[model samples]
Target: MLKKTDCCQGVVNRKDKDGNTALHRAAAKNYPQMLKLLLACKADKNVTNQAGLTALDVARGQVNNRESINILGVCSFAGVSTLYKLWQLIVKILTEASTEIFQDMDGISSDDRNALLVILGLLLTATYQAILSPPGGVWQGAVFIVAFFLTLGLLKPFPRGFKTALQVLLAFFAICFQASIYPIIPFYFYVPLVINIFIFLVFVIMMSMCTASRVSKISVMVLGCWLLVGVIYQSFASFGS
Candidate 1:
């Protein structure tokens, strides 16, 4: 019924009681309508009052916070469900986008891809056995978290083809991660969960190598080389022994 903009502007331009403007009142009352109007009228939303609070800042001080609370209710925070959904979507998109084998950053095509694939597959294979045997809920949750983080690490700016292979691995891992967390409470229900988690991590590493968008790629590469050297050295040592 009231035009808050004009009213707020009138106070902003000057001459108000107690040196407080309409913006002050709007903030105190948590009056979104009035505040918006005042802001549109050049009411200096950033201007602080004698108490050092801006319109938005003052709005936050309203203790009962009836209006602000209502506003917040309309905006939900991102949660595990949201992340999982996004992860699934990313996996699907990647799967649809690529058809090529991912080459390493170097001239080398992934000699490591095979090893990672084997590790991941075996982990998944072991997971089902664990799950049916006992409730290992905590283990399952832990596995899921590890898989999820690994997935994040895997997502890269690499071309679509390479991404797709990684995505297949991503989806597989995500499924396993979620699977482990199933029957959610009482922490004793996820013996199979750990296996799934292991599957996810193994492949995620493979994916990370192929999709090294991060600055840390050099370090990872160096570490991989060192491991390779260590393996060769160990083999030679065993032969000599």
Candidate 2:
């Protein structure tokens, strides 16, 4: 009906009594085809509903039909998923190198280990919250997911005495993983994601090699610092664009 000149020009962009436009209803109803048609007819997607949610916001809140979210293309779900897999691989590498890369297990006293465990727990909590309700949204959640998994991986090398703590952390990590996968994201977010993943993998490998006595530890540390700085610069640049 949107093809009809009167409908297209008159009420296609009209909001209901609740302030939801045709585009908002299309998104909320998970009708991607209808959404495309309405958008083609120049329906206003940015119109806020009674709750101040745009069509894109409504799409993100949809639990089952994510194609609607994908059609909207505001969140970075694709980039975040790719980063999630990449971080899993990085965690596996870190796990294998834990013995050599982490501080010697024997050197950490009970008090120190407990303190480290507490710190990791706090970091996990913060990352989980950040990912679920990100500040900058989109790519910000992607960054927090990286930090979440990295911290979780770091928690793996602790003594068996902390097995209970490890289990609790894993449970929350799984929840965070679930929350991060819901958004349907755009393609450009990959710029920052790829940069972060490449740098992290390099950082891990360099740490392992240096600890294996294959390279100068100080040299690896310096290189890691510089690479981290470069990644930060590139990530911000790409994300802003």
Candidate 3:
């Protein structure tokens, strides 16, 4: 139909009165294959409809349809912008970490659970402090402290999954704390690297000592191996540079 129509009237890029191309309609309806076909045929993804929305914007607004969003996220012409892509990558990493942490938390003793929480709390405090006072100046730390206390109060009554999700989020923040300062204090690059190494060791040791399921142990070991490989790669890169 597209070939016939294009050969007859060149309607491939033609728009209705609303200025929407076939690409826009396919993206709005979440027809990923159709969108791909249209794109291959040189359909304009950047063209806006009457509402001033491109195909990418239309896909983004379909929050309930993640398939459409993911499809558009990888499209060359309609891909997510740089900042949005970074945000998506962060969310994906944290989500995978949260799943692992949730699995590891199961079957652990109350004491061990409390210990992990304390470590996370301390890490959170350190990260939050780093954020407020990167290297040179000091700002008000009361907000994070108060927020931590409030979180504790709220977490006490929540289910295990929710608590684990919060912990994973805190861990992510703690890990990213050094990255936030790496640009400002490039000379002190090793500070955050050492902190991250310490945090990794603590996590591994805690996981090993805990009474988690066999699957959890395997998951932790897999994560440890992945991190070890990353560390080795970075070490080699640093040395070679």
Candidate 4:
């Protein structure tokens, strides 16, 4: 048992009389699930048995053990290959964009940097004015400001595990923002604002999953669909009113 402090230290890679580790046994027997679990627990796949066979070597000797082979490290998410690859590609593109957006001035010429800064400053001023005089209502303007804050937070660089802190900060902001909306805005306005906040929360979670080791692509896709529906419904409600 990994939870037992006395044994967990070397238990995962503990070898038997033949010098075969749990990883070797799982691979030789073609137990994909067991192999995946052992790997996830940090099993040493390169550990060789008395016969000089690694887990991968043993897996190769077996018949039709592609799943086990993949579990050993070939395609990381063999079960969800297509969607996983798509998401990985999307993350790569976004990571490159983040690099450009957050890059230091050392790589850019002075004039180029100044020009970019001016453009951003102008956009910020225009955005502020739009929020101040939003067509929908003051509630919509408040939601816009919160959304902008969340977007900037997501784009900025943070150290490992800092995203969780950002999520907490955003949750606190959302709660305070919602509380402030109750008295001044009508019930109809409050509904769309709540939907917008929910959408923002979902967006943050989806982005967080891009860097997380453990992910649920199906759940993320479903949340994306739900947010789309919410946005559509809010649009209709706004136009009909």
**Each prediction's TM-score versus the true structure:** 0.27, 0.31, 0.30, 0.37
Q: Which 10 successive residues of model 2 have the least lDDT summed?
A: 209-218
RMSD of 2: 21.8
lDDT of 1 by residue, 1-241 (tens): 2233213333463525554567767767777776656555666444445665444555666787667434422323435334645754664454333222233323323555344445545565465445545654345444444434433333444454565565555455445444444444333324333433444454445434433332133333443444445435534544454
All candidates in order of lDDT, best leading:
2, 4, 3, 1
Clashes of each: 10, 1, 0, 0
Checking candidate 1 for backbone clashes, the offending pairs are 131-192, 135-188, 135-189, 135-190, 136-188, 136-189, 136-190, 136-191, 137-189, 137-190
Better of 1 and 3 by lDDT: 3
lDDT of 3 by residue, 1-241 (tens): 6543213223566788988888788877889898778766756565667887777788887757577666655655534344444754664565455446454445667776677667757755764665656353222233433443333333433464555566445334433443343344333457446644754654544343222211223334544555566566655654565
Q: Pick the candidate with the highest TM-score.
A: 4
Which residue ranges in model 3 land beyond 4 Å of their true spot? Answer: 1-158, 181-197, 209-230
Cα lDDT tens digits, model 2, 31-77, are 98998887778675655678877788888888886888877775433
RMSD of each: 19.5, 21.8, 17.6, 11.8
Q: What is the lDDT, from 0 to 100, of the residue 113 in candidate 1?
A: 39
Sorted by TM-score (best first), the order is 4, 2, 3, 1
Q: Find the candidate with the highest lDDT and give its number.
A: 2
Candidate 3 displacement at residue 133 in angstroms: 3.5
